[model samples]
Target: MSEDPDLFSAISSQNQTLSTISPERLTSDQATFELERLATLIRHYDRLYHDQDSPAISDGEYDALVLRNRLIEQNFPNLTRPDSPSKRIGTRATSRLPKIAHSIAMLSLDNGFSDKDVGDFLDRIRRFLRLGAQEPVALTVEPKIDGLSCSLRYEKGRLTQAVTRGDGIIGEDVTPNVRVINDIPETLAGSTWPEVVEIRGEVYMTKAAFSDLNQRQSEENGKLFANPRNAAAGSLRQLDPNITARRSLRFLAHGWGEISDFPADTQYGMMQAIKSYGLPVSDLLLCCHSLDEMLQHYHKIEAHRADMDFDIDGVVYKIDRLDWQSRLGFSARAPRFALAHKFPAEKAQTTLLDIDIQVGRTGVLTPVAKLEAVTVGGVVVTSATLHNADEIKRLAVRPGDRVLIQRAGDVIPQIVENLTPEVNREDWHFPSTCPVCHSLAKREEGESAWRCTGGLICPAQRVERLRHFVSRTAFDIEGLGLTHIESFFADKLIVTPADIFRLHKRRDTLINREGWAEVSVNNLLAAIENRRVISLDRFLYALGIRHIGVVTARDFARQYHEWDAFSKMIGQLKSMRNILLPSLIETEEKYRKRVAKELTGFVNIPNIGNKIIQSLIAFFSESHNQSVVDDLLLEIEVKSVHFQQQSSPLAGEVIVFTGSLETLSREEAKRQAETLGAKVAASVSRKTSFVVCGKAAGSKLSKAEALSIPVIDEMKWQKIVKNNGHISVKTE
Candidate 1:
């Protein structure tokens, strides 16, 4: 990314840790932060991979982040962001190319890195079909070619258009560029084909072709590609067909989209039909009868992956019958019937040069290991995450020692093993003071992070908070970014959020600054002014409170419609926390520990946990934080949230959904509940009005029964929703 790892990478390792933890074990604040951090990092990496055609991380490393994000969203559905990666395929297509909207959207496949993940995938498929464990499902196993996804539209057996898989729905039209590729035919070989069909496949460059092209570019002083995949993508998106013709780009048909008629019932048969129609198909593809055979094929392809002319990242397995795929259907993000079994991260050995500490938004000091420049997969590696002091100590890594590093799935690469750990040398010293602010950095009990106690006074923390305030999901002020925030903060021109709004007044001063012109300064001011009126939830989230992320902020906003009401509850919470009479303090402390008890009615909201309460209290209770909020409030208006419906039975009720929802996807259920003015919570509690049960209903079901909360089955929920679009509000 955008912010670079130096600013946000420190927070990334914690995100990985959070990803591994069960959602139930995570505090509301922790989940919120992890989700927010993951969303940011994923978007950043996606832009790097899609928009720039320069991937900083390997495919395995990238897939790992997406998988973690998927898991986190699965657990905390309500907390999912508007900018969630699950909502789209890739970054937006470049403006240079003409755009095309696919007749049927191009979707991604869910990935599996291990045998257990693949086994679980099979189990889920069997569970969905209500098949016995012994059932042998036919699957089409093929190499997942590491290339740009392309869709070629054929009309009357002739190639009419070609499109890139840009953000799934819309794509860049690369018809002219694709026509230059020798592997892609101008017309179908056979007359018997659908009048209108979109053949989907991968656009790739062979290893030999890529090497020759790079050598030619090197001699010509032209832009060199990082790898074959990038070379293929860059070549295929060229505006001029002649430029594309000069590059040896190749194609392989895997599937079809928007077909006028079905040519075959099975995926294997469909591939054969596509190949018969003049498109090339992979010879390595095999029709497997069971999961074991499918896995064996995956290893078979991986073992000889180096021998392949083009790059293949993984093996993709899809249900054989097209009818089975249709029945299995699509999940919120990807096709449930398919999964890509990815290769593990590539490993390499390098000497640890030095350990550098970077402070995060929350003041946690994260150690990054500097390494002698090395290549893992296609990306160059110079640094890897040391994670925390405990990890560094566990590895006993010292400068100049050789370490085995693995390409990480998360944001930062990680040191897997210190190869020279036993070598006699002085141990690398872990700093006890903040590197930037020189404040005391203390490691809390039972915590991995060593945090600086400098609080708001720390320049690093202040800059980061300001950066978050203008983040895409927050105030979302256009034209203002991390670099601008850093520059303005360093110059003391924008020390706070209030200062950002006042930038218009500093137009002359800003115009005089380096890299800023009068037009740019004016544009920045215009963007800031546009955000003068923001939604209550966005404004609350922008405050950078410990636990109050977008979802939690929305929860609090729904609990109290206006900022005035929210502030009143904050005052009440402060009062409860500040009771100092010696005898009453002991009694009050024990009473205040109850999360379900209404200190203010806001505390009793379902899914609102004790940590959330503590964070809100701790945030507003601080004089500096309150002062900042007061200053920010003076510069903007916080708009109240609106609910469209109020008469539905679920209206304003906290409903908990458990297990696998077949009739309604988890996202669909939450959308309908919210549309009916209901709150969808992740867990069951005394405050939960009802629990909607689906197949394989879990502990939440038992908890709801124990609390005597109303339990509505999937059919009941669907019936209630289908009846005149709503049902009367009721508990019984």
Candidate 2:
């Protein structure tokens, strides 16, 4: 029920023994106990670092724990726990935020701390792929940033949702917060992107911004964050995203999650393509032909780490060839073709002065540690994070305790240990009331966080939700910036989204206000009017439904096509639920089956899972929400999305263009192909329908021939496009 002192003693004893004794010498009981201790310790730290933005240990210490656990697990394979830290990617989704199930899990990479480890990684890849020694193994190397991991999902070239890498399987939906980040594009650069793609990357804060933020926090008498990583994580996770918008957060795309189609055939090419699509990728990404080149790049990155604006813990090396990468597959925690070669963790000792609780926009209270100033790496550490009340209890930390601090990868400074544990000190307790609203702060059953029960009455939650409603991917009305929204909300001029549409009635009053003039007032009203005719997908997303992201909203729009039809269907389903399940008489199973049958059409839609279906049913079933939708509908026209119905013969075919074309540019040719409903592939594969070979066609043509795929000349390709795939051959 509390921090077990026995577990801590056992961990301390094992850590000492493991360093001196070989793993093979350890007994089975010792290995099992060590494994259990490591799992508990690692899971505790994972929650601190990932969920709470407060870490208690240094990265080096954590890595040491992991390495020790792995050694023991290897020695005693049968003693390994199912929930072992070695098998997990990150912590589970925080209870404070809504969760999103990733279509493809965002796995972490296996770490390589030394050059020998890197060489072993490369050797393992070669062995996995059954490559010959003479064959060149190309690898893409780039700096691995020390920040929060995020997944940005785009549908049809538009940014839809952004989520944290929570436990890999499910993540917290930070879409509204991410929309405010300037580095992330609202839409793809060109229309040639995949239909659906999830760009995986790090959301980081620059050292300068981190300094400025801490300075501002100090001046405002706010809780000072330990370092840039914590600042970035805290900023991105704010429920009131307007706060996140103010922070200087940057995103650098490293890889991808779920993708409909790949733009390139190699890792370097993929980075370039992703960069062209308006996502900021690392400019240092390089293609290496040999292990020596990879090591050279890694050392170069290490030398430049301190001078860079952002924090990078190490260099990441991944196989360049997509085909070879696919062949290599994955380990339980990471891809076999990739490895994160990490820099050593930087640390220093400091004194713990006090502990403070800061309430977030979502009402979750985070505990921050105020410490005596100490230098770690190049950054000055004035505070560290205790993480939670449980962590505080676990550490038994108090004011005046001399503690060891560490700048984990020179990013976030965290408490390593209490050096003066023998010194008697008063126990620190978490406050029972919300610091911001004085509302009762209660931790839910089976939840780690304490939340405010004030709901919309809490100013923080209200402003945050309002900001989300008018975000770029939502209603997106011009002139309604965060300042304006806050002003309007505070003045009681706008309480709900529908109030924005009804603001025309107050035009005269606004015009007479000190900050407002006739032109500005008219412009604001016009801007509101311009948004009167909106797309169905945007409308659905703007409603701020739980788990309903832009992609899901688009799915709903495409399925129903019309707002009236969608609304009608929802109403019908709600009515059926009410009628069929009239409590006492109907069995729950029968009621569920009846409701499911009535909603079979929606359930059958691709990618529409139980979560989305349940969210929709719940939203429509609520009378207040239905009234809000009805009111909003009265003011705006939700346009139905129309897709081109392709009748061309090339429709649904996968086409590849090779060599030089005389009649059309490659971009134009691909555009034309896509317009005709054909998918484009970069390389020749069994799935390729046709390989259009121009003059001097090379390996692709040969591969196509070998695969028995159709190979057409430039002249024939021109005829096919010109005649809408009704090709006619003429005698040469």
All candidates: TM-score: 0.83, 0.49
Q: Evaluated with lDDT, which candidate comes out highest?
A: 1
Error of 1 at 551 (Å): 1.5
Model 2 TM-score? 0.49
User: Candidate 1: how many backbone clashes?
Assistant: 0
Model 1 lDDT on a 0 to 1 scale = 0.80
Whole-model lDDT values for every prediction: 0.80, 0.76
C-alpha positional error of residue 226 in candidate 1 after TM-score superposition, expressed in Å: 3.4
Q: In candidate 2, what residue range of length 10 has the lowest lDDT sum?
A: 13-22
Task: Kindly list the per-residue Cα lDDT of model 1 for residues 1-732, writing each as its tens digit.
Answer: 234442354345444344433344334444566667777777777777876788876676678678767777777776788778777678777658988898988987888888888889888777767676787899999999989999999999999999998878888999998998999999998888999989999999999999999999999999999889998888888879999999989999999899999889999999999999989999988999987888888889999988998898888999998887886777556898899888888889999998888776677777888889998866788888777788889899988988998764445568888788375567888999999899999987656678889989899888877877886668977777667777888889999889888888888999999998988878778878999999988889888887677788888888788999989988887786566233544565666554325443446665677667777888888898988999988999999986455776566678888988776467666766676677888888787888888989979998988988888877778776667336542423
The candidate that wins on TM-score is 1
Off by over 4 Å in 2: 1-25, 345-732
